[model samples]
Target: MAIIKCPECNHEISDKAPVCPCCGAPIADHVVTCPECGKVYFSNQTECPQCHHLTGKEVAAQADVHTKPTNVHKNNRIIIMVVVAVALVVCGICYAFYHNAQSDKEQIAYEAAMASQDADVLQNYLAMYPNAPEEHVDSIQSHLEMLKAIDRDWTNAMVSGSKSAIERYLAEHPNSPFKSTAQHMIDSIDWSVASAAGNVESLEAYIESHPDGDYVEEANDAIKNLNTTTVQPEDKLLVAGVFNSFFQSLNARDEEALTSTTSPLMTKFLGKSNATRSDVVTFMHKIYKNGVSTMKWQPMDDYKISKKDIGSQKIEYTVVFSAKQTVTHDDGSTEDLQYRVNAKVSPEGLISEFNMVKILE
Candidate 1:
């Protein structure tokens, strides 16, 4: 029932009609009216037909409003990722700093322990840092063992209370830290031992062994006090020759020569087991018959003579010498013997006493 004006004929027509009746023009279902000019046009048109105004301006404004929020969201996501990355970097830096500080502390402690050069300190370090450097750990362990062994040896030497033991320890561990202490102990012990013996021979031996010893003056004083007697060089040679002649007679199995060189007391003492000198000669002959083939004696340079008075005008000289003997037995077996020969020589250059003692292997 509504009425509309037709554009071509300017005539009145029904609004619901499919065409305008006056001009016979078709009506469009998607028509719009331009407000500015009161003109009718298709709704899909870009501009108003009467005024040429753009129709999609509102849609563009709406699109701008929607797109702005999406861009802001994307920017916010990027900011959040950047913040997270920065936080991670800071945390890593802090961890690395802490780790390096801890490692430095450990290294300082290890070096301090090593500088101390104390076994207990090194042991504590090993216990604290089980992952220490391998070569360093091994060195610490080896040094500790050496210290322990040295301590043990030192204790044993002190306990033994012998000059020989301390000397042996010093000989074995010459580079030990306690070398000076051990040497001092040896000097003290040697002086004590020589003083206890209270003899010129012991003191002289001590002086010979320790020329620059701490007790050299004391030893010389002791020697001057104990001994005032001296043997002439010619008497020493005479006694030495008598000993040589006695042994030569024994090697030659000359019983008459042996009896002539031997003192009357020594011959009597030898025959104590028998009744007569013939029985003594028979005893010697039996000894020589067992396995004796040949005997040789080489004298050493350590000859000493002591003059002793035995209630006579004659002087008895006690002579001692170190000698080596090589004995060839009848069974083709040879024996090398190290022994000391002690003989008492009378004023007539005869052997008054004779004894042989084994010295060493």
Candidate 2:
């Protein structure tokens, strides 16, 4: 039996043995020797035990080719793993950057919409970013609803075209966006009504209520026109007599005479504290009882008489007079007074209302 080297471990073994004792490599029947070292081995043996070198010519060539390829495959696997890890890391960074950029974009759009204070802009922003911050979403929705409601109310008010309706809307929605427009409409309506009336009192009342009114110039012009109109002498005398009778009755301290000079309605309506005509007479009598011992009236040059229709077949006349009233008190104190008297006369030649105020010196 000749000695042989194991193919796997290069251990010496019998060539006749089917398997090597040290490496369990199956031995071929043919014997061989290492050409370089002269070590004996089987034909199937790829290496010599004595020299620790490959022995078979075909075996050495095959080993050389297979070993290099296996090593290359392992190195390639490691490189592939590293590349996969790096790619995963790069993908993660890109995803994070994209997510953050999208969030920032949404935030910026929301802020811009809020700044506009427009309902449409805010609605568009909500449509673009449904996942916007909770607080901002709720606030935008509320503001949009409010603006829509105001628009609805304002449009309804304009359609109504009534002064009271517009005024009611303004009172209800003090902070409405159309506040200025509503105010202008109210002024315009007032001006139109006052112009159509074509009366000095109505125009003067408008001017008083709206000092900075849009039709202030027109109102002044209307007043000037009315003032230029003339009054008849018979009408002036009739108005004057009503006032003279009222003052004379008041000075006389006779409740019966004073009450007789006034219409029953006028007697009842005089003196806010008096509930009945008798109460009004008693109240006036009390004022005059202790006051003047003697009173004299002299009419002045400035006097006005105007008539207005109260109802069908009923006319009311207003008399304005500047008069000198000299009063001698019971204590012997005499006062020379300048007085202004405004009196309203009924159609039946009775005084309907009397207002007396002392004119300042």
Candidate 3:
């Protein structure tokens, strides 16, 4: 029998043996050298087990073919490889052209939508193509330019008091992209319309109704500047001081102090009926025992003095009050509170109409 060697360990074995007895490597097979590591192994393996390098039967086949004559089998394999490579290159080019064509179609649609000045069409295009390309920028710029013109026309209509056109336009196109801008334009018209109409009552009422509206602050400022009734600075300060004194008197629960400052109208307004000095003192004692500590008052910028009526025999102005108070309980815990007070003063420097507004906790 012919002796064979194991590829893994070079152990010798009989040619008919299935495995080498020394290293347990299979021996009953044809083996080849691994090109990367020069290690001999079974020809069917694609990688060398020792070096882990890729090797294939193709390399061995090509080597065999080179050793033989160039013939029909060799020519056929070469033609087949060339045909497959060309087909792959053509497929790549076709895919690129198809993608480019689709992109061009979308870009043209975006431009056409903008040029038509139809907001619906533009929004639809944007929805369909959220990732717009660089080419869409020019169309967007043109749309912005058209919107600027519309804004100019809207502003002029408001200034010239011909707001009907803009109003009708806004009503007709409520869902227009410029709806927020149109609302601002309409408010500007409201300011001019309210002022030019010369209805002070309506103006004040409108301002009061729309406290946080866009026109509220501007309307208030206009009212302050356009006020025809003027009060002496000294009298304005005195009335404000008197109201403060009255609040302090009430806060301290000092009946004598409150009675001295209050007039007959104020007494009635405070819901007191025919009470003299002694009775007031007794009532104040009871109130002081039951009531919590009176909170202090601080002034705020929104607090102001305005005449209730213009140029009447009865001079009148409003005295607005705002204050932040810290109330302490007997248990030594304290809480902060804020108050807003509005007082309408008569010619006699008395608070005729006193209204307490919201409290903030």
Candidate 4:
């Protein structure tokens, strides 16, 4: 057997073989190149005796038919490729549209969540897009965490029932959802503390801190009560001191020192209205200026004190006292005087007014 080239693929093969192995082209005995047609064919046949078809022209015609089918198949493959490419482009466009629309909806929801003060709005938004691949996913998760932390801190603050705790909550979360309520609670705590103390300074401090607090009216009332209460032991001691100074100045018949023990603007003195401290000085001067040498006026232990009306921006008390006097006349005659005297003393330990209500002797 001799090696020969395949007719269709030009692969070397056995000449005695019935077909070429590479191209599977049919081979006949003595297959060789046809000189007239420049193609591979059986050399033993010039033409078919029965059909009388010439080998050179017939093989050439067969080659034309074979190449024609190959061209047709290539065109079909190109058309199928174009159709598939168009389908993929359309699918990509549809997917992009769907994702864009979903993104728009998520944006709207996110804005609403941000605007709302309610924690539930944020929670619902988180529930819908948890662990999503959207751009604002991290932002939503961060907001949810912040809200949770605020809620946790607020609950702790409320449970503790401490003013400092509430204050700390306000300091930490200034923009918290419970900000207003938290501040109000702190204000109430201050008022409660001040009220429990029951003092003017403490209540005044509360007023200074919260001018528009819920208890402002009540605070003012409490202050008024404290200022006006007449039976206070401390207040009584102050009034007694003022009475002593006034009597000491009177017994000496010293005009300036007597005026020093009285208010600058006295409303009454020696049974006169719209009186002045100068009026008291002049009255004391006239009592001892002549015919009375070494005159002495003394206050007795019997004292009655009551609340007088507030005047000249001071708390005034009406004090009634039994008084005694001794006058050594220039003529060497001695005289004894007894009087039930009434006076008004201010909280600043100063006398504002005085009168002899009754002559006891």
Candidate topping lDDT: 4
**In terms of TM-score, which candidate is stronger, 2 or 4?**
4
Clashes of 2: 0
lDDT scores of the candidates, listed in order:
0.71, 0.74, 0.63, 0.78
Error of 1 at 351 (Å): 44
| Cα lDDT tens digits for candidate 2, 110-192 | 78886764788998989988988898898788878888888888888899999998998899889776888888898999999
Task: Indicate the residue-level lDDT of 161 in model 1.
Answer: 82
What is the lDDT, from 0 to 100, of the residue 107 in candidate 4? 82
Give lDDT for model 3.
0.63
lDDT (C-alpha) at residue 56 in model 1: 82
Q: After superposition, how far is residue 133 of candidate 3 from its true place, in Å?
A: 16
Record all residue pairs in model 2 with backbone atoms less than 3 Å apart, i.e. clashing.
none
Instruction: Show where candidate 2 strays beyond 4 Å.
Output: 1-101, 112-117, 227-361
In terms of TM-score, which candidate is stronger, 3 or 4? 4
Q: Between the candidate structures 3 and 4, which one is better when assessed by lDDT?
A: 4
**Span of ten consecutive residues with least summed lDDT in model 3:** 266-275
Cα TM-score per model:
0.35, 0.38, 0.31, 0.49
| Top candidate (TM-score) | 4
lDDT (Cα, tens digit) per residue for candidate 4, span 17-110? 8766776555644355655544555444555433445767665555555555446646876888899999999999999999999878888888
Clashing pairs in 4: none
Candidate 3 residue-wise lDDT at 64: 56
RMSD in Å for all candidates: 23.6, 18.5, 26.4, 11.1
